[model samples]
Target: MPAFVINNHGGDTPDFDGEITFYVIVCVFLTAFGGLMFGYDLGISGGVTAMDDFLKEFFKEVYEKKQHVHENNYCKYDNHVLQLFTSSLYIAALLASFVASKVCTQMGRKPTMQIASLFFIIGVGLQAGSVSIEMIVCGRITLGIGVGFANQAVPLFLSELAPAKMRGALNICFQLFITIGIFVAGIINYFTSDIHPHGWRISLSLAMVPAVILLCGSLTICETPTSLIERRNFIKGKATLKKIRGTDNVTAEFESIVNASETARQIKNPFSTLLKPSSRPPLIIAILLQVFQQFTGINAIMFYAPVFFQTVGFGNNASLLSTVITGLVNVFSTLVSIYMVDRVGRRILLLEACVQMFLTQTVIGLILLTDLKPTGSWNHAEALIVVILVCVFVMGFAWSWGPLGWLIPSEIFPLEIRTTGFAFAVSSNMLFTFIIAQAFLSMLCHMRAGIFFFFAVWILVMGLLTHFFLPETKGVPIDAMVEKVWKQHWFWKRYMVDVDDEVIKEQVHPHVKYVKYGF
Candidate 1:
């Protein structure tokens, strides 16, 4: 067991609290490994996409022979095959998020993560040794399931365990690792763009090594103390909480958790809570956030950054290097977001990002409308300008929607409905992500201008929706926020006037009985 040192990292605080205790950081850091896995899975596909020729050759006998058999296959089996291999994981993730609560509740968070790792192992092995494209697609689908659980569980795990003050930063740290993984994948793909004979396979297979190590390491750590307490393992729960949360005045904290648990347990199967009338508003917000995050065009840029560069007239090699730059911008900007989220606030950042994103998408669309193609081989200067605009777009997203989009759903819902709410939210994210990611290259392939206009419209609609429906969540405490934020219905009244929080509170808390209300 590691030494239990109180590092005051998360939750709201003055500077004097210093960082969270070393042990808490260590425990939290272990959970962040799940983010690393998420990031790696996200980036690996881009690298694999760049290795098209190598991948085609490796499965040559299968793809070439199959191409001849399927009469007039206009879909280009090679591209569809690649798209399916990449997106199958996300498709599975949509399914997995729905069931993640069962894994977390029955097996606990640590064991569920171990189970995810097992899927990673099997998925990677299938990809590395597959004789047919179908095999690779299946592997990706399994990987998707693992991703689904990790994506939902990791943030919920970290947020519940972290101090309220530090939670935003640490939670944002999860996105930081995601950007890091994307950066690393971009760099590896750039350097290996020319390497023949199974380069993409090698790139894709690196995920299994870390997954194995994390899986093994997970077994030794304590479960989420809060989860244990919820399960009525009070003795072990208190000890585990004290160890991870440090020897500070944990009495109030303990009581708060127990109270929350008791309140939550009244619902029994809380996973179905999202569909009930009381839970609909937050569910709408969660699903919209997920949809907006995808529709913001980040993944479109990420999965096809190289292709975008090439369309603007950069060479294949230069396009890959430009993608690396995009990844770097993502990583560094995400770090800035981690620092700023707790300081400046989530709402301010989100609004600013949404507007900025709208402008950038508009500009990119206009640039594409110019129909500017390189006269010669490649115009490095013009390409660089487009690359910079793409980075600016990325910067806007990293600060606001990218991490906060995921962050809000986890924090905004009542504990009673959080699991189901997140499942619906994240699954929506993946479902739209799957559609956009799969159809992205094909969309651009058919009509580049039309697709850019498609995203341009999405950005405008997202800006309107956020302004009308979403609440400001920065600095608010998590456990009671669902009640606190609901008293004011002006935030969401435009969307569902009939289901206003003020109207509901009159019924749920007659005379404002259970929770205190503020103007």
Candidate 2:
């Protein structure tokens, strides 16, 4: 068991009386391991694609017969085959995520995570031992199911555990772990890239280490205080809350949670309630934000970064090295986001990132459109410029869409339907992710530089949508956000609304806190 130490890292004080405790941080850190595994699965393919030995073994005819094909960059598989390899996992993930929504509610968060971990380990074993393409696809699909559960559960668990003031930062830590996973995968792939006969298998199998760790970590942590209270086990909830908050005086905190739970309990049917007009605003934002997140072209680049580098004139070694560097930049930039999310707010950073990304993608597209020599033969300056643009693009994504996309939807819904709503949003994310990741190579093979232009256009569309719909959620109580932010019909309303503590008292449902608090 990890030591439960109370390390006080100073920051904007949380909504509670005391500092955020070390237990809260440890629970969140361990839960965020799911993201690391998710990123590892997304990234390991890029390295495997670069391995001729793996490709030659898996896609025999394509590798042997295609004399003029770009052997080193692409895996030499036909477009249909590549599409199947990537999209199959996403298809399974979509289904599993819906199931996880119910599983988390029934079995609770920790058990749900262990379920995901088990699936991940099983899939990894199959992938490493695979002797056929069919077997690899099967493994990927199983892994996707695990990813679906992990992705849906981890952020929700973090949000429920976090104090309102620190929620955004802790939630952003989930994205940071994702980049770390990608970085680790890239580094592993780099060192093993030359290990010809079975290096790719070794790379695919290394993810098991983290999956096991996450399962063990989940065992040691407490269930979310929110879930505990909602279950009407007030005595246990109070105890858990004290452990997490590290103080005995939880009167205000307990009342707040009771109020939130009572409010969520208002619905007769979660689905019917979501269909109501009052709920439309937040629900729409959740779905569209997820859609926009995937369409940002982040995964198209991440899942194939090495191949992209090779496409732009990098040699095999240089391409993998460049991918590792991109992963590092992604991690560092997300740390910037985790630190700044509460201070700067979500919309501003998202807007700034969208502008930079729009410009970078447009420029990269235009450059690629120009007649350029193949991988090893392009101008050194031109190749360097392309690399620089990709780096900037990744940095922009890491700070904005990468973390905020996962963070916002988790907090946007009321607790009554939060699991169902978040599950749908996550499914949307993977659905669009499937479309983008599956079509990327096909688009690159046929449309070539046009692929970048296609992505840049989507970025513009998303930027417009964000400006109109996204709100500043930093330090806002989840229920308060529902009444004041999402329920407000107009975009400018969030900035215009004003409220003091008396007004807040009026806004909170009187019957909720009083009855649930037994006073």
> What overall lDDT goes with each candidate model?
0.71, 0.80
For model 1, how does the per-residue alpha-carbon lDDT over 414-466 read when each residue is reduced to its tens digit?
66566677888889989998988888767765655566678778878887777
Q: Give the per-residue lDDT of model 2 (tens digit) for 337-418.
A: 9999989899988999999899998898898787453333466678889888999999999999999999999987877788
Give the poorly placed runs of model 2, Cα more than 4 Å off: 1-15, 65-78, 266-268, 373-377, 488-519
Candidate 2 lDDT at 83 equals: 64
TM-score for candidate 2, residues paired by index: 0.90
The alpha-carbon lDDT assigned to residue 8 of candidate 1 equals 14
Model 1, CA-based lDDT: 0.71
Worst 10 residues of 1 by lDDT: 1-10
Question: Could you say which candidate leads in TM-score?
Answer: 2
Best by lDDT: 2
Instruction: Show pairs that collide, candidate 2.
Output: none
